[model samples]
Target: MITAPLPLDEDLRLRSLKRLEILDSEPEEAFDRIARLAAWAFKVPIVLVSLVDEDRQWFKARHGLATCETPRSVSFCAHAVFSKRMLVVEDALDDERFLDNPLVLGAPHIRFYAGAPLLLADGQVAGTLCLIDTVPRSFDPHDAEVLAGYAQLVERELEVRSQLIRLQTAHERDRRSLAISEARFTTVFKETPVGNALVDLDGRFLDVNQAFCAIVGYSEDTLRTLTFAKVTHPDDLAEDLALVAELLAGKHTAYAMEKRYMRPDGTAIWVSLAVTLVRDAAGVPLHLIAAVQDIDSRKKSEKALRNYHVELEERVRERTAELRRSRDALQTITDNLPALIAVVDRDLRYRFNNEAFRRVFGTPSVALRGASIQDTLSPEVFESLQPLFARALAGERVTCNEVRYRADEERVWCTTYIPAEREGKVTGFYVMSHDVTEQRRTEQRLREKALIDPLTGLANRRALQEELGAILTHVGAVALFFIDLDGFKGINDRFGHDTGDALLREVARRLAATVRAGDMVSRLGGDEFVVVSRGVADAPGAERIAQALCHALARPFVAGGTIVEASASVGVVLRGTGDAARSVRMHDTLALADAAMYEAKRAGRNTWRLARHTAADKVKLNETRYPAEKAKSNAKKHSEF
Candidate 1:
């Protein structure tokens, strides 16, 4: 170990060094061994692995040097990183840098010196490896190079330690984010079909679920004496402690990893843990709630799975020389997996394929191979991947989204394309997808059931969300005309649902004819059907159309020749981003239109209400008060308006 000279101002250097936070740290043996070896090899009395930070220099390891560190102003290593080369003082008395250095002239007298800079990942010269001696001596080059190697070792250790710290921090963040509840605790511990426990901060048992007691072959009373550590196998203690240490340090608040647990009967139970920290309102850590899924079944499953994986891997390795064999193996795996899989070439031609694709697309995997994607799948999906395919062909892997229409029905769902590569260049692509068609169908059916009226097929409240979501994306202006029929509930209660249904159906037919091209008329159920118009030239355009629908409906619908009065409350919400210069958030725009429709009902029944967007207009208005109030008022004035 070499003790380099502290500058003439010793006290000033120590002050600058304290803020680095690396001084007098826990014993990491790698550094301790290097410092010891350096001292003997160089025949010097002092060696230190010193780091330079914002204002201080700290020692991770030191030998022959009594104090932990010094200030940057009086340090040799601070100068070493700036030089961007080794700092070697064959004789401190002769060197100009040393003449003014305090250690050279004072107590820890320094004459010979050598140091190497430890570079951090960010290119900051974080610290240096240094050596020193009291007597003047010229060190050998081999010794200097070996010292440089030791410095590299320190740099590597710094990286490993830093990563560990980061991992601990992430773990702690997860712990802090997730909260605990007795309902969740009981559900997880008692009903989870696995062993579980609640332990205090010190690892003492507080509670164990029935499954845990049964698994350990111990009564609840019998398990109370033991702390968690007492039953943990020796082999599993290190990792268990490592995670716990991170938790204790507040570096991690929760932990989840696989490890075995020792049962009370001295048997080690293989398990997977998902544990979290419980805390009080003031954020003090209280206890740990852990779910121990008895991995014994999963372990048994894994054994079968591992055997299959090994067999699969071996077969693939044997055929690695041929791409076709490899593709075949891939197809085999995909066929058995629960998802649909397909492959496409640079031009979107089908390449290697899988069984799931065959099942869904109605073609054999081999038959589909080499066919164009557009020829096999819908044009919508093929066009969506056009850019992604182009990118993949240009040697880039792409994960792009697409939507495909179901050939069996008029429905669509999402898919993703993952480009495949070879030898540093993308060659083709792999498609792994799930059929979300059912999900979309479910949503549509639910919306229809909730929002659409059975008597009149019209857009319901649930349908409104989807409609607005779609309409807002159109940057072009839109006219939202909310039409509430003048009288319908009275017809239903008096004339029976049969005649009411017919009157509503005729009203729907007349309204549908009055709207222009690209306009939508949906029976919002009962007597309310909203007419949403796109490319509305102006408010007058909406007004003219609203008047036409009102006039068309006024003429007797003649359902059973009962020509009673039927009027409408037309509220037109003129929406879109205001002006060509400003981009209104389309989704928000649709919501505004929805609010304005209810407002039309609010103003009066049978007449229309209109609101146009302007730069001066506030987008966020009181929607809650208007929607419910409008629905109730409209129900009351069913025929009056």
Candidate 2:
């Protein structure tokens, strides 16, 4: 009964085989181990974990065959996948499908055969778990059932392998997601460049980065043992700790403040501190994140600027004192002065003009006042004056000496310029004018004065009292000191007045330049001078200035072709706000200051005496000398003010 071969649905069969997802996989011991035992159990010559393909049966493991794949036209298992029921041939010569199949007749001659369909998970035929024997045999239903049970076991293993592949894929996805999240966390924590810390619930540091470690000046290991409180400066401790406690108690999620952090060496640094409490899923506090930014440098700059402002104020006070002196002298020497006095703005516009200006310009000083200089001066003068205005407006103080006017009949000499100031940007100017013609005439009359001393303008005495007063007001927070030149008479006699006068003038100028604004130097008489420094910083301040003066005057003073030198004894008296004990009274204080000066002279010729004000200062200063009670009732004045 040779007939045409059965036409297999090749595509569906291949898809069914692939759904197993087991093609070309390594021989798994779970399935292969089953094949080995089955080969032995059935006492068969061949056994296979075969996956059916479109036109072939491929073996995952073959017990009795060396070939891995066989052509389906000759394959015995191919027919099995097309049928769900087990196929058995009691004798191959009797079955048409197997009667001429080459595998049944070839090298591994299969005269008897039994194969059961391998069921898929989707309920379709996948392949077969089959056994083959060389000789024809009779079949029993029970034996067919028993071999079918082995096939089911192989199917179970295939299912498990599929499950493992899915589980492995899921695990990889989860791992990738976690890695991305951790990388983001690392980026956020490390790059901010501020001091940041992660601390446990008990406020112990778990981790901190390099910036935080540098700020606190502690190693990671050392900081781990200490809580945040240990690094807080004492002045800021109470407030910072209170915020910490509040956050821990759930009063707030975050707290921030400007604080000071103490370094390992116990120095404090200023920082703006911000802390946030991190919580767990249950809303219970778990850790704290602290961020600290150092502000010490910025704070120092501000303090330096403040100090600069104070120094600037002292300079203004000195200039104000000079102006007040000139104002006072105007009352004393009004008749002998030259020309007019006026104050103008940066534009050379008048602020005020004196009575002399009204007579000289002929126009009402008020009418010409607040008008530009171009109104009265020529174009050349106006152009020259522009640069002067620009300098003054730029905060420079300018002085013009001996300005000759083409408009005047006589060649005139005067000093005129503006005072410079500072604002946020632009500097405003204040104009001051002085007439020197009469003063120059007076100076010409005193030929003897010029010969005596350059500073004092005294015939015999050097310039003294005025320069002493000038120095006193310049250096604030100082003590006034007096000094006496000792053992000077003999030197003058031996050297002649020419050298003596030179020595005196040298001493005067040296002393004036050395001391701060608080101290003053005066020539009371020949070989005697007093030093006064008010608002002295300390006794040391006065002592240092005095020592400097002594060294300066000790240097050679050359006069009239002769070289000579002299030394002075010094006396000191303390004054001003920082002196808590009001020890010195006004008149009596000057007397004491004077007496101390004399005592230094008496002690020898070159020593200094510092007035002791502590005991008496506590007694006499019990009452406030200033801010006196007035006739107006205190309540009424308070209301008015």
Candidate 3:
């Protein structure tokens, strides 16, 4: 056996590996696809993109391994990382270095090994893309070339992932800075004294500052329902409409003229009004910013003196100065948000949109205003969403989840459509949307963590009980095997918990390998595990599974430089297919199975005992027939182990 040598630039290699920041990340489909493809190409049972950390080799993507990592001392990938070349060993038993290796002598029994070293962009070796098999095999030059190409794929993926992380970090920083700027601008808008209002191109009020509501003598809610035409005096309405038409036609950027407003109680007030057109980034008119001030006093006093006219003119100038601050603040707030905030009328035409809506639809927010949804969204998207929008406009508040395609990305969004109503009538809907893809992914990960055992990567007690409950609910025949490792406590005392944990992981792998493809194996916390086999036709089939589990657990486990032998005393129970038989509760079944497991220990170690419980007997469970203390009695009898 030839012991592997270290690389010449080991320090540089370690630094480069750490810099990628790919270790311990959630598995990605890109890397998993590479591993699966390699396994299929080589006709090997296992393939891994293994990274060599300081003390272990961690698998980023694994094709067949149950474990995600292993100590570096036993890692075959550790030897391959020494050079940027393909390393292949046809057989390990014949090699000097592996002749006495525990991996060669125990479970998984690796004989064939091949690896191609993966390198960073800086030309430092980080790890290897490796293939392994239990049987010895030979490879040719073509095979080596193909394997080397796979290494290049891994290197490119790592580089791309690192770049994406950097880009995301920079984007977050920019967003934070923009938020700060928007907040400062919002403060200025709130503090300004001028009567400023933002209205849709069609003249409906979208937002109004406090001063605007005061000057109009209407609450904000009331103003939202009334268009500029509704409040304008009949005599001045024609002139106001003509000026707005000129602005929309691009013949005028703004228009100012004195206008008469009719109050709620049949009174008329004269005001000086200046309206400016606001456009989005792409130079499309979006909103009309209107500044209004009460000039009735000035008009009435005009005949009294010229001094009053000068004083009123000076006040109007001061008000106009403050209006500029409000406009700047509104623009800043709308431009920074990624959320899609918009309003649409009963006619299905857009009334307003924030910056994100413009970016996604590939149209300026100002230009998109007053356009139909069918015109803004793709045909497929429009057809699917039209009904939801209609429901909102019909006075139904709606919230729904949707996935939409942006230029080159798919994003999950939670959208809420609120009905904008006035005087008990629905006028339009307010649409607000925000991305929820990352949040949903996080929730899924948390659910997986709860169900999967962190130590062995198998199902845990929670998963086992849930599966059993599901099987019972569906009324299926099941075989349950409760396995307790023999002498596991002694092994922990003698070898330490780390080795004990390693032994358990290896044992779990063996148990999983022994079961049929559809069987469920779970670790029920420390030294105990349960196997649930569904769709079993008879007790004999379950007995065969029990026998297989016993023989598999009797094998030796290699961990922490030690070859530890162990055995399992398994208790088996079979439930037949019938409503009555499946009606048994999960806890009672587990308790009966546990009682039977202790009986197996008494019968002797390294064997299985089947506990028989009929449908009628299960319905009549009590201390008299199958006493609850039977497990304790069995344990006390076999306490010498």
TM-score each candidate.
Answer: 0.36, 0.37, 0.35
- Of 1 and 3, the candidate ahead on TM-score is 1
Query: How big is the positional error of residue 376 in model 3, measured in Å on the Cα after superposition?
Result: 46
If the candidates were sorted by their lDDT against the true structure, best first, what order would they fall in?
3, 1, 2
lDDT of 3 by residue, 1-641 (tens): 34456678888888888878889989999999999999999999999999998788899999988889987777777787865667788998878777666667775688998999988778877889998999999989999999999889998999997788779989998997767455434422332334667789889988886767777788889999989899899999999999999988867667889999888886778888878775554456777867676785446433322322222323332334443234343434445555787879999898877778766767888898789978877788778788898899888988887657353676788888999998999999988887878756754684666987889978889889888888777655688999999988889989999999999999988998887545789999988999997655466667777887998899788977799989999888777777777677787778777767776787888888777766575522223245557667756634655
Residues 1-641, candidate 2: write the lDDT tens digits. Answer: 23223336556656655755788777777777888898898888888877776666789878887888887667777666655678787788778877777776777878888887777676666677888788888879888998899989987877777677778888998997767455434433443345668888776888886668988899989999998878878888899878888988867766779998899788888887767665544556667777676776446334333333233323322323342344432322222223455556655677655555555556665676687777866777677667777777666667665554455555455555555444554434654445456656655665545433344543322333344344333433446665666556677678888777777777776776665432345666665555654434456556666666666666776755776656766766666543343433444555555556555555665667676555535412213221233334323322321
In candidate 1, position 333 carries an lDDT of: 51
What do the candidate models score in CA lDDT, each in turn?
0.66, 0.63, 0.77
| Candidate 1 TM-score, C-alpha based | 0.36
Pick by TM-score: 2 or 3, better one: 2
Please, what are the lDDT tens digits per residue for candidate 1 over residues 273-376?
Answer: 76666544444666776656566566533433333333333333333334234444345556665456777776778777778766677788888878987787
For every candidate in turn, the CA RMSD to the true structure comes to 27.1, 39.8, 27.2
Query: Sorted by TM-score, highest first, which candidate order results?
Result: 2, 1, 3
lDDT of 3 at 165: 76
